[model samples]
Target: MTYLVNNPADFVDESIDGFVAANSNLVRRVPGGVVRATRTPPGQVAVVIGGGSGHYPAFAGLVGQGLAHGAAMGNVFASPSAQQIYSVAKAAASDSGVLLSFGNYAGDVLNFGIAEERLKAEGIPCRCFAVTDDICSGPADKASERRGIAGDLTVFRAAALAAAEGKSLDEVYEFASHANDRTRSFGVAFSGCTLPGASQPLFTVPKGRMGVGMGIHGEQGIEEVDMPSASDLADMLVDRLLDERPDGAASPRVGVMLNGLGSVKYEELFVLYKRVSERLEAAGLTLVQPEVGELVTSFEMAGVSLTLFWLDDALEQAWTAPATTPAYCRGGVALEGEPRDDADLAAAHEEETPDASEDSKSDAAGMLAVIETIQAKIEAEAEDLGKLDAISGDGDHGIGMDTGARAALSAARRAVEKGCGAGTVLMRAGDAWANEAGGTSGALWGLGLRSVGACIGDENSVAAPVVAEGVVEATDAIMRLGGAEIGDKTMLDSMKPFSDKLAEEVKAGTPLRQAWRRAAEASQQAADATANLAPKKGRAKNHSDKSIGHADPGAISFAMIVSAVADTLESLHEDAA
Candidate 1:
């Protein structure tokens, strides 16, 4: 368990501040994360690595001269927001291009992929590679479905080395992908990791038992077995990895990583490595440089994982390259003084919005009140929502909703008070929602709000039919952005039906408030219906059967917010009438 914490809510933020301060010589603080303090050679492809916090040396600890140029840190066990990813990437970029890499998790994929698109849109070249190396997460044939664990180090190191050599983004990406293909990792856990401030760990292991093939993010292991001795555990890990060695390897030269996940100590890892090394040698496989320590870690997870990185000539050279970072420093390399401090790491400016007429601005104020209502409803149901998510997914939905709603409310209030138009207010709120929540739900909500605002425009008070159209546009945008269909047991399940019902009622000449009320009923019904659905997207994919009796948190949250909005709209319309 994580014992040293003041406020669990502020754990990550406080940790980052202290971490940057401690490693100031190697890294400097940026708004979204940290970038190397040492200057990079101009035209070097910047390697930006990141994911949720709590994995120390895997990310920020690896940022320095020859490793990652920057790390886009996020919430503990959550993906960094797209804005955060963009901020770090932009800060790290230096004319050539930016290559983003992270573990292949749903939140990280959505957030990082969006940031990459935004960077490209702004003419800053960006490419992303997700490290999928844990063999236990999926079948051998479905390697792409695997989660990245201890193997993140191998892929990120290879990519960063290629980038440090001033290789093009394409070459760097290929190197990373190759490294991912060659790397395979498996883990055993004696206990689960506890997040800061959480009373219980994400999962548990019975005393004298071990969880095999566990995920780093407190994802419960696929199988459980009787606890074994250090040598036995080591043999198990080594044998499992050996069973799925990369095909067509002429030589058995491999780089091995014995990773301690949080509570596991160096003594334990080195002891286990003793047996692991013996097993490899007994199997006639030649071991190259072996790193036996915590390269990546979870917070207070009593477990260890072994990564086998099959090496070729190029990979061997890359692996042996001297890279100096705060945590993993090797041979000396030339370094110029730090470049000029970034001018725009944190966005101090407001987003641009369309001009609004007086009536439109007034309506935006009304919308603000409606959003407040929605936020209150979310706040009230946050814990329940999280419980719903925990049934089949990471128990983060409640926290994510609270974070996004609060952020959106804050942004919307500021925009409305500044006399911004409705479109501007909604757009700003959407960005805040995505930036603060930092998950799949966050991205979907962001896209939905932005789409609605884009449809509404800024010149006039939104009519019922126009509002219905905006809702439909939001539904379409969310579907396109998240790749989730109506039956995917996502927010789209509720939102699509609500938008459709609203559109149908508005077309039939129903009053806007009444149309919204009618549509909200459909939304609630759809949310309730999700209890019977097995999730077809996100983290719930592997645990689809577990979700059969629980409604999707996203769908429930969307239904509640829309219902609140309907109430607010009905009250406002009655006052106007």
Candidate 2:
């Protein structure tokens, strides 16, 4: 049921026959399962990328003008015979010579290694390049132990470029090797993929979870983490790529790829990219180019892989070169959507805004620092938060909070660098919090930031009354947008009471510090009360009584934040007085 194929025994050959038949103009079948381009361009060093047949658009589908010159095919998820390797190597080589690139596997090593010797004997200069980019496969002492996943694209592209440039056999070999060195890939599977015609999946990761570092053919992953949002999953994959990347490289331009295994939606791949871009930016890694689609796949697998390439000038140039094939092609860099100037947005504002001042800068920094501290506190309690969410929700609050907090800090830093006013700085930071933090948390957190921004306008320093107004405004937005009011067992239970108390204290002419302290205390009290209330929204809403004993994570988070805000205000007031 997992795989869709006519016959298990005829799977590999049938697939190869179909591919060659479909693209007779570009490829021709060679002896021993290898396929070569019908016409090899002279003076171009040829790259023949290959592997077991199941991972499509990989060793085989890549054969074209700027990609592979040929592909040595093997049985389904099995290594190709040595004859298969030799045929492709000899057939694809031209005056520019030939380079053999494949995933790093034991059988591939022996077969391709022998193929090289045979090519040399026939007076054909054939060199070998093995891709070892799957970071999930093994540790440093044993990098060779890893399997090749989506990182194969980087190697192929690099080799394609080197060959296209008319590089000699040694140069092309080195370029391919460099691509392997610069590349790193990680994969996660929601479910295992079935080999063609197989009734059962090669492996199974339990439902609602992901197997990180899973192999292309249903091998076990390093660990299984509860299924996270698209962004969270994307970040986990990107972070691993960033960490495992080779050093001493100029231009940390990444060729980010979100590869869908067989059945995932192409649009979902873009969603994956949206998260990937945020994570890459957060880590100070510049993405020179990004690719999103199914570049490689197992039959009917629900999974995605991220491949990062550290590009040099040559690699960048080659990747942009013209190329076309059956499943992939060079569509010139798609235009980034129309530009919007933030300055124009600010200018269009109907309200009068205050000029930036040293005082405003200080206030902005102080508030952000408070948020940063609150983020740290929340991060410390992530496990507990996740456990709570798991009980009646998606169990992502802990992860979401950590991401939102960091996003806020980064946004704050950018605002500070731009000499923005306190309100604008906080507004931008909040936007980052919403946009970068994935899922429902992003929506709520973003609304909170917008609410604060709406009230502050151009204020340089917060007076007791303005601070109270901002809190009240933020509370209102949370209520309207989140649709959760007091006793609804959500953040509003804490934020609403906190805002009212703050406003009352401010109107009574209480000192800002005292008003904040009262607000913080009231917020805490309300947050604790949520444990007794039935849930009313999101997945928690489904568990009406089940969520009764667990305090709403949003409420606890709100209380912790307000307490930090109160502490920050106290510090600011002391400095002013």
Q: Which candidate wins on lDDT?
A: 1
TM-score, prediction 1: 0.93
TM value for model 2:
0.56
Instruction: Give lDDT per model, in order.
Output: 0.84, 0.71
lDDT of 1: 0.84
Name the 10 consecutive residues with the lowest summed lDDT in model 2: 340-349
Best candidate (score: TM-score): 1
- lDDT at position 380, candidate 2: 82
lDDT for residue 234 in candidate 1, whole number 0-100? 82
Of candidate 1, the 10-residue stretch with the lowest lDDT total is 568-577
Q: After superposition, how far is residue 103 of candidate 2 from its true place, in Å?
A: 0.3
TM-score for each prediction? 0.93, 0.56
- Give the per-residue lDDT digits (tens) of candidate 2, residues 440-532: 565566556756755664455756777678878877755654455677777788888888999998899988888888889999999999889
